[model samples]
Target: MYIEYIAMELPRKLIGSLSQFWKINVLDIKQLYDSVEKLVFVSISLEKRKTDVVRSRYNSTMRVPKALNPRLQKQLLLRFGVYETVYPVETTPSRTVPDHIEKPEYVLQKQPTVLPDKAEVKDVNQLRGMRRSCKLAANILAHVQKNIYPGITTDDIDGMVHKLTVEAGAYPSPLHYKGFPKSVCTSVNNVAVHGIPDLRPLRDGDIINVDITVSLITVITLCWHQYVNSLQNNAIKTCGPEVPFSEIGASIFRHSKRNGLTVLPAFIGHGIGRYFHGPPDIYHTLNRYRGRMRPGMTFTIEPVLSHGSKHTLILPDGWTVVTEDGARSAQAEHTVLVTEDGAEILTK
Candidate 1:
């Protein structure tokens, strides 16, 4: 006998592909040997829900593939079920995550926000505290950018930032937060943000952007955004002059100038508070964010300008964001507290 199992919970996309593959390859196995006792086909139905969890069920039916063994089929079905249960629902594209493939479940699931929070600071004193956080972030990036080069591993950058932040009696915000595995984001070349520090050495002609944030007074402030824009613009204006930062920074800045592209004001700074990213997303271009800048308001200014397109890629680690076209990207960032006259760079 042969059994046919219905797979009701499978996504239509995968179901379609599997059905086609089965018909073309498995359908030709028409009969079992005289010793063949029974056959079963298990169909698993997958339903995608809002929470990134899938509800799946197994259907058993008589079939050639199923006839191999009941226990084997059961094991296969169980294994697939378990995989669907724990795998992430969203993933980076193949071109982006070439080293490690993301699970299909995560690729299909709902995504969390790119920026985490909308924390606010309403008082001037509170703003000062926020600036302190920004300064820590700024100082950390300043050191990393100055030292990044061909012989330096990304992990070195992470270690340096981690040690510096902790030495200052401050917490490196990204460590163990939301599963980010690094103290700082050192996105080199194509990697954009959240690049895990590895043994990968910075190349002579390569570019990298380091993102840092610190926590102070229960507030999370971002400091890399504005610094990126300022540095990139400055690099372009200076050409081959001494950048004080890494050569990559100068290359990105100088390349941007050659493109004759105006840094879009619409893509500049951002506010931070309870939430990691808040309103009044500042841009380098000349547009106003209705999100008012008030005292005690802390934000990040990391402007990313590309030699070609700003399109990006996510690394296998899930946090690194890189340029898609393999073009160079330059960024400097600073977390700051909004003030009456201007702003205080906390991480500086």
Candidate 2:
């Protein structure tokens, strides 16, 4: 069962881009805030389970016992060439943002936390700031895409993100926020959301999601998933003002089910703006969260779709979330603004 949180107000807008190697598919609703907009590309191909005997990684031929527990079955599957499992490696110290760049309020706090209790209505000036930051975040993601290839560690991507963000006179929002030690999040294959960057080199045929957030006068966040040698699809849709927030998740759930996928309900999109996380608590599954979109409000709608069971677990590092059944997951996100006539994609 999902524990519902008190609904709060927030801003909304949408941002998107299409690449030659990607297919964009719009699913449903949810809202989150940030200057950055995210697009997730998920490519899933389900195959029949194999019962044939196979060679283990140790070069010995063996057959996985059908009576083994699910966890052991997953391990044997990995060993028998179902898919490669991702693991964390030594990560370097957190990269630094320039002292001259503006920082978020949470960075100055002893506990470094910001709890947004209400949705914020953006004024003209605030909206301008959001656009600027969101554009910067999108540009940074485009730049990072050029560097993604086999043998490049996620930590290298983090360094590139940190350098580009600071050089642009903006702060990387993920740095030092709530004690997170990386400037960006890189989740590969079975790893779900909030996968911290480490020394693991990306492999060919690996799929990865790169989540980027930056802070100028306003904070913006965006995420995109790419295949090392393949591609996938993701898209966003906007609604008119006063629409029930719950409808977004319902629509996405329907779309995912129709596509033979499951939505991971544990994580929700959130209200974003000056702060990294805030109200609205955009659920990707059907729920009773109370709220309606209003003009000038901004938020994000990012949903993670799984090719297998939706169950998940957090790593010992307290951040990296992985699929409990070792299934692969994909995610897509965008920050949107509710306008009088309709919603706008700010990060587009």
Best by TM-score: 2
The lDDT, on a scale of 0 to 1, for candidate 2 is 0.69
Q: What digit string (tens of lDDT, one per residue) describes model 2 on residues 1-348? A: 111111222122232222221243433223223422443322211231211101111122122322236786676456433446665669999887778888877787645446557777778988888888888888888898888999999999999999999999998888877788999989887788888999988887676888888888756555454431111112235355888888777777777777766789998888888767888788888888888888888888778876666767776677888775566677766677879997886665
Task: Show model 1 residue runs off by greater than 4 Å.
Answer: 1-121, 225-259, 262-268, 283-289
TM, every model: 0.53, 0.73
* C-alpha lDDT of all candidate models, in order: 0.49, 0.69
Overall local distance difference test of candidate 1: 0.49
